[model samples]
Target: MAESTYTVTGMTCGHCVASVTEEVTKIDGVTGVDVDLPTGAVKVTSAAPVAEADVRAAVEEAGYALAG
Candidate 1:
């Protein structure tokens, strides 16, 4: 498995974290997602190769943007 941590912006509360987590979980190979709202960080665990672009897209789809 592969793990990565990304900085996500616009996550102000628990609901924001949940939204991102839920959306990211839908992507294939995504085993787990841990969203830290206070720090705006997202930790992801995947069974296979996962791209940063994929994670960014997922977060954007959930109404948030990946921090540059």
Candidate 2:
């Protein structure tokens, strides 16, 4: 498995965390997710290779922007 961390901006509360988590968890290769609200970071564990574009799409669908 591999891990990736995405810096998400505009996550201001627990609801934001839940929303993002749910959105990201829907991705095909995602096996796990950890959201740190204070840091606005999301750690994703995957069983196989996952594209950054997919990750970015997920975050964007959740109504937040991923920071580069």
lDDT of each: 0.91, 0.95
* Local distance difference test, candidate 2: 0.95
Model 1: per-residue Cα lDDT over 6-63, one tens digit each: 9999988888888999999998999999988889989999999798888889999999
Q: Please report the candidate that would top lDDT against the real structure.
A: 2
Each model's Cα RMSD: 0.7, 0.6
User: Which pairs clash in model 2?
Assistant: none
Name model 2 segments beyond 4 Å from true. none
Model 1 TM-score, 2 decimals: 0.95
Give candidate 2's total backbone clashes: 0
Among the numbered candidates, top TM-score falls to: 2
Off by over 4 Å in 1: none
